[model samples]
Target chain A: EAGVAQSPRYKIIEKRQSVAFWCNPISGHATLYWYQQILGQGPKLLIQFQNNGVVDDSQLPKDRFSAERLKGVDSTLKIQPAKLEDSAVYLCASSGEGSGNTIYFGEGSWLTVV
Target chain B: SQKIEQNSEALNIQEGKTATLTCNYTNYSPAYLQWYRQDPGRGPVFLLLIRENEKEKRKERLKVTFDTTLKQSLFHITASQPADSATYLCALGLDRGSTLGRLYFGRGTQLTVWP
Candidate 1:
């Protein structure tokens, strides 16, 4: 019954600093996803992992953003040399492998770059 | 490029009235669509899902209608209440034969119900 869990609910960093966010998906969920949500905007997916292997990462900024779900139960998203534009909420979500399964989201990690 | 569009403006309606929100997409076809509710400072919560072949879906007070030809999905809340006020998001599921977990999101439409 527990939902997805994220760490460091709020973060503040200067431009060019590096930030990392951690997420633990719901129990028994095999698919995990990372999404970014800017103010006044909807959440955009950054990457997806299916049991420790990446399913999709086409939208991830390879040069700056990196994510891994080595064991498949949890995930970490890192942003290096963060920019002002990186100020947004980092959301972690998960779902079962079956079709039509509902995706559950965490409380989100809020990042602010000044 | 693929794009999803939702009303950027906030919708204000009476608490007893029905609230209707629109979501439109262009440049790509999805096999299914989903609606989510997002409160301030919280992540999105799934509300409903409707596949391309389906015309309408309902969950309690929530209803969703999808039109593949029009590339549009409509979400309605009947007998709305102040507690139902929040930003609503529409996400496009993967195209047929692709992975089903991936989704693309819109900017979301904010709704406020007044007493």
Candidate 2:
């Protein structure tokens, strides 16, 4: 079975520019999540979606960050007016229905903001 | 605020020896803890999950122990190999009922196995 897929494995952008990353979760997975991992740090949850509806996005920066899971299978995360501090690996993950279940993650999209 | 911590030091062990990594957390109660392995330039892969009600869980050569009172979990890989050299991450599932499945992760520990 194929794992989660992400687009543009690496991206470079200027401080004021905008960037976007895409993710395709595993087949039949209902829970999708977006996380940002700074260098030398663990991943921080940015948003989560269950199907076409958002489950949690308390950590997302509304001013610059936005994400949508259209059709409940593919997702896109966007950061407008990116800052240098936004340089990090954007990771996407998916899971089934339970909290104790295993979650599958994509290779991640690495962003470097200048 | 809830916090998760893992050993920042790189664990070096012989290829045939067992490798043990530690994860500890403070504040907030978690219903389950999970372990994941990550290679450089890659995302984490799920390794194991242990619930608070369960004291131990094993998957082949991998074993996990959870101590809720101490707020700690230990991951052990027996007969370790060089291929097992990677960053190990621990995560806690924040429960708010209905299994929303939000996880808080720890800074992973790097492991190296010597031949």
Candidate 3:
């Protein structure tokens, strides 16, 4: 079976510019997630979607970051007015319905903000 | 505040030897824990999961032990190979009386196996 798919494997933008990342999860997966991984750090959960509805986004930066999963199959994460700290890898992952379900991740979209 | 911590330093081991990694957490009682393997510039791949009720789980040459009393998880890779060189992350799953819960991850332990 195919794993999670992500687009624009790498991206570069200037500070204060805007950037977006797209993700297509595995077939039949019910849960999708977006995570940000800074260099030398673990992936931090940014948002989670369960079939077109948000499950959790408490850690999301409301002022600068937003994400949506309209159809429950695909998702997009956007960051506006990017800052130098926003330079990190955006990872998209998908899982089944249970907490014990294994999460599969994409190669991730690398962003470099100047 | 809840915190999950793994050794930030890299671990170096010779091939054919056993490699051990530790994950420690504070201020949280997780229902389950998971281990993931990550390569440079790539996302993490799920390796194993152990429940709080279970003390140990194994897959192939990998073994994971969860100690709730100590709030720690130990990951062991047996007969390690050079190919096993990568970062290993430990995540804790918080159960909110539902099938889904949030996962808090550690900074990960980098393991380097040399031939």
List, for all models, the DockQ compared with the true complex.
0.77, 0.78, 0.76
lDDT of 2 by residue, B1-115 (tens): 7788897658999999999999999996989999999999999999998988999999999999999999999999999999999999999987846644778999999999999
| Model 1 per-residue lDDT tens digits across residues A8-92 | 8999999999999999998888889999999988888899998899988999999999999988788999999999999999999
What lDDT is obtained when candidate 2 is compared to the true structure? 0.92
- How does model 1 score by TM-score? 0.96
Deviation (Å) of B60 in candidate 1 = 0.7
Candidate number that wins on DockQ, 1 or 3: 1
Lowest summed lDDT across 10 adjacent residues in model 2 chain A is found at A95-104
- Candidate 1 CAPRI classification by DockQ: medium
**Which is superior by lDDT, 1 or 3?**
3
- Taking all chains together, the TM-score of candidate 2 against the true structure is 0.96
Go through the candidates in order and give each one's C-alpha lDDT.
Answer: 0.91, 0.92, 0.92
Tens-place lDDT per residue, model 3, B1-48, is 888889656999999999999999999899999999999988999999
* Residue-by-residue lDDT tens digits, candidate 3, A51-71: 999999999998999999998
User: Which residue runs does candidate 1 get wrong by more than 4 Å?
Assistant: B95-99
TM-score of 3: 0.96
Ranking by lDDT: 2, 3, 1
Native-referenced DockQ of model 2: 0.78
RMSD of each: 1.5, 1.6, 1.4
Across B6-67, the per-residue lDDT of candidate 1 in tens digits comes to 86568999989999999999996888999999999899999998998999999999999999
